[model samples]
Target chain A: MNKYILSKKLYRNELATFYSFLIGFLIALAVGSLILFIQEKNPFDVFSLMLKLSIGSVNSLSNSLNKAIPLILAGLGISIINSVKLWNIGAEGQIFMGAIALNFVYINTSINNSQIYILLLLVSGFLGGAFCIFFPAITKVLFGVNEIITTLLTNYIVFGLTIYLINGAWKDPASLNFPAAAYVSESVYLPTVLGKLSSGFLICILFTLIAYYIKDKSVFGYEMRIAGGSELTAIYAGISAKQKAFFAMLIGGGFAGLAGAIELLSQTHRVSTGISQGFGYTAIIVAAITGMRPIGIFLVGCLFGALTIGGSVIQTIGVSSYIAEIIQATTLFGALVAQFFFSYEILKKDEND
Target chain B: MIDVQLMGLLNATLQAATLLFIAALGELITEKSGILNLGVEGMISVGAVSGFITAINTESLFLAVIVGVLSASAFSSIHAFVTVVLKQDQTVSGLILTILGLSLSSLIGKPYVGKKLEVKLESLIDIAEPSNIFQVLLSQNLIFYIAILLMIFTAYILKKTMFGRRIEAIGEDLKSADSMGLKIAKTQFIATCVGGAFAGLSGVYLTLSYVPYWTDGMTSGRGWIALALVIFGGWKPYRTAFGALLFGFLEALGPRLQTYGFEMSPYIVKITPYIITILVLVFLTIIKNGNTGAPKNIGIPFFRENR
Candidate 1:
């Protein structure tokens, strides 16, 4: 337990971490470069432009922050689940369920039920995400089917459902044959405190803190990680793998649900086919880049959000946003490979030396 | 509703089932040998695009499928390299491969958009040609038959063949299998590649006949659904076919419900398959006591040295 002795014994391999990140960036750049060349554009300009657009001006910064909000929450959702060693690839489906829940509260409320609507929105959003995720939780606990495939398959089916809704039940009466829904009441809307800045950004931060607290401080969090580290040992220690997996899935789903609520209440004010468009999916990259840690998740989440915002700017600059996606994916690849060094110690034998 | 139309429905079901069946069969083999290729979806997408581009440019469906399977196998080799050879996480590598495949396919497929394709299909056999039931059940695209053939072959290889026993043995315990002179790396490598090859064929079916046109993400969610169906079928050959048909019926049923005059909302109906998957999966779990009926080391990446 001696601090100095322990410090010397604990080996941290900086080289591995550095190389992993470097390797990721290189591979990502190579992959993205293929896209860039296909677009008949210079890869250097696209990469440089992407950086500029993401962090260029005050206005640009605001847009990036707004987009990053949902990603941060969704990414943490991924991290939280990973910490428990359960793969919840259905964040996309959970978000859809969350957005739908938020949308329901938005569209069903009477004009007078504004305050009530806000409360209902939060509750419904949580339910939407948790409910979508609950299906996979049951399967993992009961059938022992890998949640990875089940969850992803469910995500697809959920998209079909979303498409059905917009084209059917939730079609905006006022719109001219567009698959959209009626705008939520103004009173139910989440406010924008900064100019053109979304309030959902705050929601993202709040969730991150909650995740950090739950993972780092709570006994359950410690047990969850222990379970992930070794399921057999955890079981021997009297931890229920089923319970751990179930709760992990639920929390992940719930975070995605809240993200949906924030989107419905703050941004579009309605659900459309565009309600998805890969925000939930991109959260995976954020989660991985952060090394599945909460605070680290915040930084990486914002970075990815900035990529989207900046990618959008490139579209305006006559470069396709497709480049942005390539960059984002590549960066994730780069970041994930790089972060490994931080997690493991590299050992060399004297014989080798 | 389930009477005379069973044949035509059967045929369409066969076609649809064949697409996923091919890939699922491959997935089954690999899983049996104890390496989970989570990149099935990505590999399928890549195969679809590779087949579409090559076949469309050449106007030969057979060549297209070959390219599709080869390309898919090649793409899958990357996954095998990482998880099997390099000892990376099977799930993560599979996912990364998926992401990479999707992005790469989308990027590569962009140029082929809005173009018409021409493929040469063989003349139908005269016996099944006359009867609707026969036509639906017996006559299908060659690939459909190929898929069935692969399934039977897989069953035979796994249950009756020595190689199959070795695969099962490896799946049960890698160390024991290796100690018994099993070529662990070669068997795993071949199994993963072959599994990937069928997944590629499934993609080719998508581009050649199902949609018969090239579009981005045209496989939709079929890859993942097929993967799920493989599990729901309890990883058995006969059951896999039944499961695929069941899934095919539900998927087709979504559109068939449109014929009703009530004007059902798409959202509620669209969720049918997903909801059913959850319900059935949960039910199966409760019935089986949360133990997987799957290969023991299904998702654990393989390394011979470690064993």
Candidate 2:
């Protein structure tokens, strides 16, 4: 009996990546259209309206950018961890830790100085994220524990703690009994930039560049590539693969933490359970769809930012905001399938042939 | 008085453990076949919503459970195809399946939110005395009794059946299994799909017997916990069932503590399962190989080289 077989291509197909993105995008759009049709709305009209809401006006653009800021930073974080093949799904928890740390510094300190406050917040946020991930990272390195479930479990605990803080200990006396932390001092709020945009956008860009440099060019990056690609090869090269894994997770966590801090300082002045809006989770998709590249993550973050802003926009047309989630998820599935065809081709032949 | 309270806690544990036990046992099958499907959370959600919608429309518990299992299996089939047939990364595929399941379920479930169920599975017996230990033990929804039977049957099959040995062989040494003429892909696919069906049933138990209402994202990470329980239970059916009960007891303890006027925040109590899981991992690591019970090649995609 003879059958068609799948054979892996010898060389990488550069065009495969481009085709994958296109296919994934098309699939996402198709899903969105189907959902819209079910809702009895013209898919094209809603799509155009969503674009307008996300990027049509300065106000909308600013909102979109604000939404994208955390996503970009968090995506970078996910990219860092992905490079080392460490599945740390705890970025959401790290973001909360960062916010908690930033708030701790802001409220506990007597220093009302804006410059010092911002500087301290950023540092504390990074440390907070790094600290939160240290447990899983160390456990993985030393004990061979799987970071995936541990990190995922840690997320619920962090979120639970966040809720407890907002409702009980950290409740803002001035919030009029609302379950939210007190707003940051006026001086500590992020300064405005171009037409309603926060300076946080610029910081995100800066971090993106920094991440690119560290991931693509730095010695640490070289070591990480070796460690991630093959542990034996890295060990033979005299590089400590375990150390690299630990540091990768640490840096990744820090990036997510910083994202949390920026989101709080720039957009939401007070901490609440809804502060994240699942940016940590969306960032994972952004990182994956972009192949975990820094610049690509930024672009994907922008698209997701648009989706986030547009999700609420479509609600006016009676569509559930969950459409964005569906589209995002579908895109990932399509992309993964597309990635399969990149290196292998299936040949069909008669079984008797 | 204390006996009554203890009995209530035990009763709650049975209900909670039954759902977790169903999911954990399914995952055990999937893992034993060397495929790690991490999308249990998403599959459970799909099952919950689908079963709920079915119940709302048909008012038939059996139909709802069937729909729930089928929907979850259909959702998980994507993972099975990608990981088994395509030989893609199991972890990433599992995650994408999860995200897809969640979004798709929420999309379909949008209309059913807050809708009261037309019918739900009823307990097999009614206890005249709420504090009767025997009555409390016996009087539970059909699913709970079914779960116990499933647990025993699964244990028996795994320990005594040729099919179970084949699954174990494929998981432990795929190459040997393939050389031995075992259908590796088919076995793994069937295992993962069956695992998904159990997870789906877990969801049915959650919505119909437990909450008896339709809500978005109702499973709420119980699927993830069940995955961890697969490890805590040493990948054995009986041990896993015991772990489920342990988890169930912890889950029940949280609410019971609240009822008892414990000053601790409910949020802290809610996080106990996760913390316990972490501690369990650490303890396992300290005592032995942390992942000792995991099937070898659990996440590796099998590819036959022409050699």
Candidate 3:
């Protein structure tokens, strides 16, 4: 009897995610094929081509890993915040600031310790992101302003301010008309580990695992989850919402900031105006779709990583990668629709039970 | 000394004020009816691009404006359907619409970049070049007049009309509205569509009448400014106009201050709108931060469960 129950529980767990993911994948395939049909392109050919580009070759896997780097970090950032029930929408700004700070260091300081260099970038990123969250959280707590608007608008500030800096003071000497700062020294840049994969992907893995451990095994995680699950209960238990919100935003900003710094140091090795490109915003989707699970985020990040690689190949093949965007938008719509079904059942009523 | 520059400033201020004023007024109507539309920015961008495109294609400015309004209304209708019918979370769904609209506009409107149009010039005022008096008082576009009339009408309707009273009731408590036999969906949908249409027209004004050009991100945070102005106005129509005017003056002040050759850093002046927003939000919250000012059901999405 116990074996039967255990087997059933295992079956249910496997079946739940299996069905949900199957539904998600089928919807994506159907939509993708529909678009291809309208364009008179063969769906099977495109699908095969996308698959080959994403994983059929060594270079494609490397491309996907590199693309997955920021996404993994972003996934972790979203996972961290959602644990505390705080939506950190300003990850983009934090990431932008990280890139800016890293550029400042890259242009100004000359460093030779390549191993320790990674630590410097990570710390700088964390601090920069925390700074962005400081004023916004203060305003939300003290003045009753919504952080959603304040955090979102901060993106504009980061953009305009960075552009102003690059245009006026930090313009690369060789970039001519375009406003980009100087690239980092080779010593400061992360070394490529395996087949075009930057060491940044390893950093993402380390951070994500650390984040998972902290969330699942730490007391801070418990306190935060308790606070998030029941604010009233937390208050009754003497936890302050103000403090929780502040701490949550701080941690959230720090992770995002670290992601940003690493992105600059490892990938571009320079700061530019287009540093963010909605990584922070997309992190929210990643977090939501992963159900805020650190492990689930790991898998989802890789899937998106593959999609992005596939998209690049499509772009090279002379098609706009807006097909990818349409897929993302539809997936978002589908996920939200699916949320209603996760814990609910619809059945026809009958006299016989 | 103040009068000479002041008159020119005032004229510019009035013109700038009219565009956002109409938007804030319309937003006020919906918010007062208890629906906060975060899709305002997207709707505005669509309106501006659509209006600009239609004007350029047709060469008839009036038809362009109509197209702009209708285009926004059509998009806004989706917002109404999603929130009212589907019962999805308003905040997230609205933001998604924004992201989608931004991408779509960029994708679709890529064809119009760098193209110029013969903008039908509306006389701001038939001001003579030599006379400073004419420059200050006589020069103004017809849209400015329409915006002022809109503010007056919005204020009057919110207080006087039976429909306005129904909106107030619905906003206060949708259950009460339903108990009184009010058509909940119809009222909310109409209010939302009207609000969206106004937001659209406001965008159209930005592109066609004020600046006759189509550039990506031309709205440039103006839609959000209109949202803040709604709060700054205490959700009242006339006050909303005043807030819009105040913001307009602040916006124009950045350039004038630059022209005056003061040794101020451009960054400080450039962030004038944000600084103004912060100050206005602080002031409003301090005075009426309590439940006294904001509409009771402003952010809460109504569910048709009880009634």
DockQ values of all predictions: 0.39, 0.71, 0.18
lDDT of 1 by residue, A43-149 (tens): 78877887887778777777788787778777888888897788878888888889888777666665467667677787799789888888778767756766886
Give candidate 1 misplaced runs (Cα > 4 Å): A1-19, A110-120, A142-145, A227-241, A316-320, A331-353, B1-4, B120-123, B126-130, B257-269, B303-307
Question: How does model 1 score on DockQ?
Answer: 0.39
- Backbone clashes in model 3, listed as residue pairs: B124-B139, B124-B140, B124-B141, B125-B139, B125-B140
- Candidate with top lDDT is 2
lDDT of 1 at B162: 99
Please tell me how candidate 3 rates in CAPRI terms.
Answer: incorrect
Q: Model 2 TM-score?
A: 0.96
Regions of candidate 2 where Cα sits further than 4 Å from its true position: A174-178, A348-353, B258-262
- The residue-by-residue lDDT of candidate 3 on A201-225, one tens digit each, is 8878888888898688887777778
lDDT of 2 by residue, B89-208 (tens): 888788777777877888888888888877879888877556876888777989988898899998887779999999999999999998999999999999999989998999999989
Per-model TM-score, in order, reads: 0.89, 0.96, 0.87
CAPRI band for model 2:
medium
Which runs of model 3 end up more than 4 angstroms from their true locations?
Answer: A1-56, A82-86, A105-111, A213-217, A229-231, A289-293, A296-298, A305-318, A321-323, A338-353, B1-8, B128-138, B265-268, B286-292, B304-307
